[model samples]
Target: MQGILTQITALLGVTVGAALIAKFLRQPIIVAYIFAGIVAGPLFLNLVHGEREIFHIFSQLGVILLLFMIGLSLNFNYLRRIGKVAVAGGLAQVIFTGVIGMGILRAMGFAFMPALYLAVAITFSSTIIITKLLSDKKDTDSLYGRHTVGLMLVQDLVAVLLMVFLTAQGGSMTISSSLIRLALGGLVFIVGVTLLARYILPPILRRIADSKEFLFLFAIAWCFALAYAASRFGFSIEIGAVAAGLALGSSTYQPEISARITPLRDFFLIIFFVILGAEMSLAAASTVFLPSVILSLFILIGNPLILYVVYRLMKFSRRNSLMIGLTAAQVSEFGFVLLFIGRELGYVGESEIASFTMVALATIFVSSYLITHNGKIAGAVQNFLAKFSEENHPQREEKPPVYDAWVIGYHRIGWNIVQVLKEKKRSFAVIDFDPTVIEHLTKEGVPAYFLDVSDVGLLSELPLDRARLVISTIPDIQDQVTLLKHVRLHSAHTVIVANAPEAKFMRTLYEAGADYVMTPHLLGGKWIGHMISDGKASRAAFRKLKKEQQEEIRSGMPVQEL
Candidate 1:
């Protein structure tokens, strides 16, 4: 017991030291954790030697918890909203990358099964890493960020399915027979869970939610119970854990449950990454260095190229395509998990595992910087990439009719403004970079232009000078700056309203010649204050307001403005 405690202490100490160094170097803490693992493993200090099994158990728990949290946050409606590009594009990239990756590995003298496993492993991009980086860069709500997230979610679902398929193959039955049995079992489990979630879980959750402690405990219990059941049925505990969370996902307590599990998840995940690192054999890795480097290059370059072609064919702008493609240039955490499974299944050896691990480490390390500085990278190569775009330039062959109002960005806030404009019978044009948004508006017979306000050339094409009012719902400071500069330069008298999420940016926008800068957070607070001051803050009134908002949503009208 003393020895185990000492190992834990040493592991934590090493992790902290490595994390501090990684932070100083401006690298991801994940890189630090893996380094710590290598240091603690037999390759170095050998701190985890006797307690390796314990650490492995902790790592598996981490993965199970992580999948549960993922299921809790998975919103099917969100996937639907992102539309075909995310779904179709995600699947297309995976299939193409897998095929090409397998071919590359085969040519390099790998057998079929190992190459197949490696290929599938490389096809996924790290959701956790990308989400963290996107949040850090404050691009979580950006068009490109949304698309990237949507694509990752789709990939995640595919990974889960693949994991289940692989688990099925682990049995003595033939491939087809195993698959058939698993499918039938999966169908029964899903149906049973869905029925329970819809009818049984909600009421129980609501009752338990009254006591936070009980709710939290029940969530953990449910997760482990389903996980155990899944393992019994020959599926992985990861799938079962995710299924449990999915069952509870529609409950009112999902957010609270997720919050309660996150700290636990983070704590265990450190162990998981460490175990992953500790398992790597540097000697074995050395044998496959050349092939690993080749695969790494393919992931870092070829994966992005595939996405670029996919996005361009979907009519996305060169800049957006570049950003999205660059974001996907790394293999995912699930890739590591997949490789680990392959090792366990005897489909790959230690050298192959080491090869893929090196590829993941290399691609993740480089892609972090690539995604964070994607704007600069895209700007530098914008000219060169523009040549490959379906639209070489943002072109409106015929001049759009002059309008009373021009709405830049057709998302949440802009959508509300469009409703107001329609009600007032104002002539307007919606400007958005997202092809999906533009297509939707065009289909609705709304005057919409597929133009990014950030592009000075695209801004020039729009008749902003003639519009009496120009409102930009885009919260990006650079894009807003570009719009304000153009409007101020060309139409000094036009009223320019801009949106800024942070109050700190309000003064900047105002100074940049914005007549009014709307801070959504502040606006929401002011609205609540108004309700209180007007004696409309009663519970009944609040419920009535909610009802009205829901009705508006149901009727396809925008609710209150952000």
Candidate 2:
């Protein structure tokens, strides 16, 4: 105990120093910890030496806590909202990338199993990194951000199933029987957790709610207890942790539990990253180094392009689709976990695992900057796309001399703005990328064009600068930034109302010369607060609101069939 504690103390000092340097350099804190581990590792200063087992356990705890938090945050309604896009678009991305990645690995002299495992593993982007970056940017509610989150949820489910298969792999029973036993065990465990959470747990929770200390202890105990139970039933401890959190999700105490657990989770997570960094020592081998670089390049570049094509086929605009794609340009924590499991199962080696570690490190570092500067990156890409559109895209010979008002990316928030324009009997036109939206709007006698709003060359042909007003309901940062700049450049006096999904980018749009910037997430919350303050939270008010919102949902859809 004394020796391990001493090691931890040294590690703490080393980590703090690295974290400070990372902050000073404006780099990711995760990258810092990885480097800190390398510096302090037995391979270097040997600051941490005895019983690596303890650190390994702590790293697993970090993973469990992270997964549990994700389980707690799972929302069925959100999954339902973006279900098709998340499942279909996400699968398409994997299919394309998997095939390409498999070919790359196989050609690089990898065994079939290792190649397949690496291919599948690398297809999943890091939800942890993407979510944290998006949350920090206050963009978790943005259109592209929302799609990215939904896709992460889909990937999470797939990861869980993969873990299930891995868990069954080590059993004495045959694969089919092991799977059957595992499924039955899972079913029983879920039922028991459900019953307890619904009935027995709440009463226990109510008593603990008043004591912060007790609540925190209870949550940890409950989580570990579920984990132990799952392990006894031949399920992985990670799955149990996730199931426990999901069981508690309906409880009112979730917020308190999450708030209490987050700091602890983060601490353990640092240990996880440090251990991963120590493992990076293996990646320095000359044989693996070249292959790692090649795979990292594909993850950073090809992954986004593949996902962008998928989203484009799903009818998302170029700017929004590209923004979403950029969020997924790195390999996932699950990829690391899979490589670790494969090593344990003798399907892979330390060199293979190290190759993936290097890939994760490279892609995460590059993709962090990609996501951070998405607005500028997408803006630059849009410029190239615009030139291509001008050179090749078919254009209407005749164009309207002027539109009284123009609505860009007409859906969601645009629907309400369009309704108001119609009520005022103003001449307006809608621009959307979705052909069905254009068809529906045309059938309704609205002048809607199915075109990319970011196509500056195409937009130049349309007299958008002559419009009295321009409103963009596209809740994507890059889209709003590009549109705002283009409109301001052409006609400084136009009343350009743009949408931002968050306050930070709301300011960005305003600075880019938008006359008015709307952030629906912010505005909607403030509106609700005012309503509640004004005594509008009554049953009658809710009843009226329910009807109006239902009607709005029907009216706001891009197409009735969709």
| Model 1 CA RMSD to the hidden true structure, in angstroms | 12.4
CA shift of 199, model 2, Å: 4.0
Q: Give Cα distance to truth, residue 426, candidate 1, Å.
A: 23
Q: Report every candidate's CA lDDT.
A: 0.80, 0.78
- Model 2 residue runs over 4 Å out of place are 131-150, 163-172, 193-197, 200-203, 229-236, 315-320, 340-351, 372-376, 379-562
Using TM-score, give the best candidate's number.
Answer: 1
Q: Report residue 260 deviation for candidate 2 (angstroms).
A: 2.2
TM-score of each: 0.62, 0.62
lDDT of 1 at 90: 94
Weakest lDDT window of 10 consecutive positions for candidate 2: 390-399
lDDT of 2 at 383: 74
In model 1, where is the ten-residue run with the lowest total lDDT?
391-400
lDDT of 2 at 463: 73
Q: Residue by residue across 82-191, what tens digits does model 2's lDDT show? A: 78889998778878989999999999999998998899899999876776577557566467877887787677667766776786786565667766877788789878
